[model samples]
Target: MNERDVPGWKNCDTMSGTTAGTTAVGTSGTQALDTREPGAGFGEMTRRWRDLTGESVPLPAFSAGTRAGLRGRFQATRLSDTLVVDFAADSAFRTAGTPVAGEDVVRLWIVRRGQWALGNSRTDNETTVSAGGFMLRHVGRLTHFATPPRTVAQVFVLPRTLMRERTVTGPAGTAELRLLVAHARMVRRTLSGLGPAGVEAARGTLLELARAVAGRRFDDQEPLLASPLAQAAKDLAAARLSDPDLSAAGLARELRVSLRTLQRAFSAQGESVTGHLREQRLEAARAALLTAAPGWSIADVAAHWQFADASHFSRAFRARYALTPTEYLRQQRELRAR
Candidate 1:
């Protein structure tokens, strides 16, 4: 297929002669899943996926009675700054981020088959969504989702700039998700068929659709942050863990409240906003260190969480956990070995 034929992508190349090899960020066309045979080189494809998306997607464990291998046939097409990809996996797996950079894709997925149990960063909660469903995630957020065998999903990897500019993005509440999933399927279909210019022209519609999924309620209004202002503040702090400018004052501005009001709110909950944000950042860095990949460095994790530097991050971590980041990571590795 020619370059113009593929939507949202240019200069496409495939690592294989056929559908089963490592495909690049663009697709030739909608490639079908190769259920006839187990896909080869799952490890390489998954690593490429890591490079493409800046996510560390761990390979799934094989379930009883299910065969293994990368049965996932995923194809990508870039539309302007956004990437529209379709994934169909024959085995169940979980995915999470190990960010080299602080930013994560704000992915909007339309579930066509099977189910996914999504984990949230702001809270210790999992939302199980199935076919005819959609999920909207924030930048830098971590999630774990399991795919059933023969599962098919269409995902729109939206640009964070578009989200930050056109919409007030946040977590999707249960009440609004049903409405969103229905609307996204329609939008996903419309996007799939559109050419580059057509896709560009429809940017307004897509942004509105995304805004709906992220923050809007069933009434199509942006859902108000849950009360008990301290909790809401904490949630925002956790969500924006990587932003260096995410101070108490900035948090107040985002919340549209005065700085004093924001401080007072957190004080009511027995903590200061500034203190809380600092702790959240330190904690985020600590967690990142525990799961840091082989090639990652202490400096990378520090910068990712917007810490002053490696030394500052280390000091804070050691103060909190009584162990340096390296020591803590070593302990975690030893614990896993047992």
Candidate 2:
């Protein structure tokens, strides 16, 4: 749809489809995309955000010299299908994003580092978002937001193809939406510390959170877990390495696939259910030994990976790494110290 047809067709620049003019100068793969430059990088920031969201983002003169001395960075990382972006503008600036076309996505905008002067084009109403407050923006609407100098904000853009559209100002179930938004913010904030632990579970949980925030009345949360069921099952098992209650049957039940279906999936990969669990457990345990906290006892490591005891964990670790768990941790620590 065009800008005027959008729900809150703000008097902002109409966002078009992805622009092909900007260069890809940030991190490759799924790490993060950042724009860091001298003076105002408004043009670059706009392009970088467009590349991630596949929408046009235009910049407005919000500072005395927004097109001159504006300096800062914008960073974006992809987790599963979601795009998490953090933008810091050292200069005062405004973002006039045109209404996103043909996509019914929702962007969770969290004001993490600055105060924002937000404008709604549809109602000609303006609001302020201080630090720690967040709002949701429908992709198919006009967008206008301005920040004073030295501002930072984060956006968690999630596709909402699975849920009904909610109005920007008056979505139903406000309390539930608040809880889900807070949970999503926390996930993106501490994801690095999680160190790949429970990534699959986290991804699945995010799907649920997004649906909840979108005010969907469905019980199934798999609109985004469209990956191979077998691989998804394996990821779930890996995420639960420390739970001790994760088993083939439990995994099947959790993943909503029958035990027979799971068995058939494993057979297709030429692996037994037993062998798959062992390898996942062993790999998780080994990874933990490498980066685990200093005070983590051997038993702690073992229990985290669901091993029966320290001896079993050590034996399994040695079998895979050709070194005892203690030896591996010590050697790695000494190397780091050196």
Q: Give the top-scoring candidate (TM-score).
A: 2
Candidate 2 has which clashing residue pairs, if any? 10-121, 14-98, 15-98, 39-70, 40-70
In order, candidate lDDTs are 0.54, 0.55
Q: Kindly list the per-residue Cα lDDT of model 1 for residues 1-338, writing each as its tens digit.
A: 22223222222333221112222121223332222243324344545554333333223333323323334556654433455566776556554322223445566766778866655421333665577766666534344455777677776667675454232323333333433333333334454455544555444444554564565632222222112245546656777889777788776665555677667666666788878888888888877887778889999999999888899988988899899888988898999999
Report the number of clashing residue pairs per model: 2, 5
Candidate 2 residue lDDT tens string, 1-338: 12223221122222222212333111111211112333324465455445544432323333334544445555554444566566665556655334434445566666766776667542343776677666666545545567777677766666566344553433322433433444444455445544333444555666676565455332332433222345556656656767768888987676555677667767777886778898888888788777779898889889877888999888888988899988997898899999
RMSD of each: 20.3, 11.6
Off by over 4 Å in 2: 1-55, 65-71, 75-107, 110-117, 121-134, 139-143, 146-165, 168-213, 217-284, 287-297, 303-306, 319-323, 326-338
Q: Which RMSD does model 1 reach against the true structure?
A: 20.3
